[model samples]
Target chain A: MGHIVEKVQEYLERIERSSINAYIHVDRERVLKEAENLEKNEKLKKRPLYGKVIAVKSNINVKGYLVSCASKTLENYISPYDATVIKRIKSQGGLIIGMTNMDEFACGSSGETSYYGPTKNPRAEDRIPGGSSSGSAAAVSAHLCDMALGSDTGGSIRNPASHCGVVGFKPSYGVVSRQGLCDLAMSFDQIGPLTGSARDALLLTNIIKGRDFSDSTTVDTPEFKVWDEEEMKNFKIGVIKEFMEVSDERIRERVERAIEVFRDLNWEVVELSYRYIDLALPTYYLINYVEFFSATRRYDGRRYGYPIEEVCGEEVLRRIMIGRHISKKEYSGKYYKRALQARRMMKREMLKLFKDVDAIVSPTVPKLPHKIGEKLTPMEMYAYDVLTVPANLCGMCAGVVRCGEINGIPVGLQIMGKPFEDEKVLNIMIGFEENF
Target chain B: MVDREKVEREAEEIVKRFSQILEKYTFEEAEEYYILEIKNVLREDEEPSVDPSFREEVLKIAPKTRDGYIVVEKSRWE
Candidate 1:
């Protein structure tokens, strides 16, 4: 274990400017010394993830470390305590390496608008690492960390996981505690694992997920059994035609090929549709605007920093303004209440779709990551998250697996299951990524 | 054709809601950014269906307007 930590330290130092702009801070000595401590603990008490090095998203509080959220607002700020997920991972003997960079304040989809600058795609340097969980995905992909913890609010984890060619899981909303996460949105935000493999993600999630006094939203959840590679080949999966038809041909083709692999393993494929999926974006944006406005009050610049508006990115300002507008008396619940109703419709559609299948399958992203400094109008960027938002609005657990490459860039296949059926999604993802 | 009533209402809503944010930015910078956004919204060429009261309410949010163009507090000083 000490040897591996030494290697990770060496790699962290060697990767100049980072192949992917992943880490916010790399305490090389701290991580290595912790590794040495674990190596010397002769009586290991069966911690689920013994000595595994984990990179955490900056939003989740880690004691004695800065919680920057890739924003200038909290750059010098240090967390006084650990988040529920962090405490659990620590209890399980996981070594915390450092904080990963993200889209500023967990805003934006392309990962370009972070205060720490953008994280590049490790697979293709010019391309973006999709975010706001950009650094966490890049860290695992670059072998900087074994696994990472990231927050997913409207596909923050899964989007980057798809773009960076890794496994990203967003647990059943409210099932995973959010006590320590510097939230993007109270209802939609969740902390989950980004890893090289589904197995690691599942192991990490199980360690952190459960009832916590800090977050009443989390239930006393049990770990679900994920099927082994051979067992999932026999599973039934549904492909949302809405997802396949919307993506670029190369991306859709890669997902199609992945589905074929599943079929060759004897899995059944059913074409499914719930047409109202178009409503997810406006609904997602509205819910996000209102909640994000509410979540950001602490950043009045006095607590975290003052006058953050000067250093805060445009996307952050946009949300703060939009959220502020939504809270006014006139628009009260017009956009928000309607969106919730739309969410209910989405949930109904998801429920009906999941009735005949064990898991729903599609490319986690419909397009490959675009190059950095390449300008995309904000709406075009928002369009990138179309595939994953429906899963979030309906409160389903979904996993992203690096399925194939498009023009040499990676595309992810998303496996989504009914609410709280994260284990089922994880099982299918393990089977899906065996080829990788 | 661009519906003046619809544009007027959207303009008002922008000023009413964001006047505070505008306080941080120059009134012209905010109004330029805000008014242009309101005008740029691709409105359908249909008869106004929004409430007349809402239309009046929206127009009231704007600080000034004349000669078919929404006016703003000048930024030449700041």
Candidate 2:
């Protein structure tokens, strides 16, 4: 317990000295108190995540802490109550270190859009940490915390994890409760864990997942299965051709190396393609705009910190305006409805592919993360999500594992499985990690 | 007199622009698409229990309050 407390204190000091701007708020007193309490209580020692320090993305509420979502709209807003995941983590003796930064309102793909300042990639100081779960990924990679909770909407968790070289897992939508997460796009959002390893991610997922009355979207999910190395050879893995086509040659090479490892293990590697793969980004953004607009209606300047339109960053404003335009009564059927239809098409395609394979694999991001402060158009930034949005669009489970490195920067191999097959997807990730 | 032809032409233009955006995602041509079965989960009809201090707690964070109620700027004519 004493050693764990010392480690927690050391992390606090490291966070203080960190230049990445990974954390938006650090409640040092609260962190120390929790650590001291854990040291005193022998009963807490039996908990699975006992004395583990966990950083939470700013979008998820931690009672009495500022859940700014890395935006001025909620910059000073103290959460009124603990989110369900926060309650679960605390119960398991996980120490809540602080709230980490993210893209403002989780609207952007790069951490650079954060109002607090972009979270620099710890792996490459000059490169951007892919976002909107940027800070959580950066913190985990930098070892400022043992694990972090991040929300994924269109690759937010996995994207940053890929850039920072850590494990990020987005459980199937509705598997983990979304009650306290500030919605970026409710239909696409899932609160997930980013950790240093695949097994740690599974441990956090086990604690945070289950049916929650507070979030009716939650369903009765099966418990996470322990990894069985013997079962690894029996599964078929699909490599999406479209994903490979869009990725940089270096990234593709790294991902192919990972696939080759699986092949050597006697797992059959199949080439698959989806005709609508190119449409995933547009479809994802369209739904994101509409849902984010609907969700942010509560920020009317009275109940929250400020009117969102006036205080939010540019990317957020762009989405809201686009949402407003698309959701107009006369335009809804043409844009919003069509996007939903496209979503359905994507889900169907993924379902068909899953019938022939245990899981699909791809590069987590099509290219290496751009240099921090790079001037990229919104569309260019959106392109970063091309390979990762399919999992969110189809409401399937996805996990990213550090596969290989290029130019000294780490790349991730993405594994996606059918909805509610989170355990299988994670087990496959663990197997890959072990093999690599 | 209402310009019927002009109005129809403008409406057509708007539809054309919207269609172009949808086309970018291949949604304009998608014929077969799945619609999820959305069933509303209704709670039992009963008087809801409330905490006695709930209102006070909510008001604590409201930007403006008057006479124990949230206050807002007038946005419409009576």
For TM-score, the strongest prediction is 2
Candidate 2: tens digits of C-alpha lDDT, residues A158-276: 99999999999999988899998889888888999999999999999999999787777787777687767786657899988888998999999999888987887888999998877
What candidate 1 gets wrong by more than 4 Å, as runs, is A15-19, A43-45, A228-234, B1-78
**How much is the lDDT of residue A44 in candidate 2?**
78
lDDT (Cα, tens digit) per residue for candidate 1, span B50-76: 334533432333335565344554445
lDDT of 2 by residue, B1-78 (tens): 224444345434433454565687644344322222335645568888665665776677778898999888776563
DockQ for every prediction shown: 0.02, 0.16
lDDT of 2: 0.86
Give model 1's TM-score versus the native structure: 0.82
**Every model's TM-score on chain B:** 0.27, 0.46
| Error of model 1, residue B36, in angstroms | 41
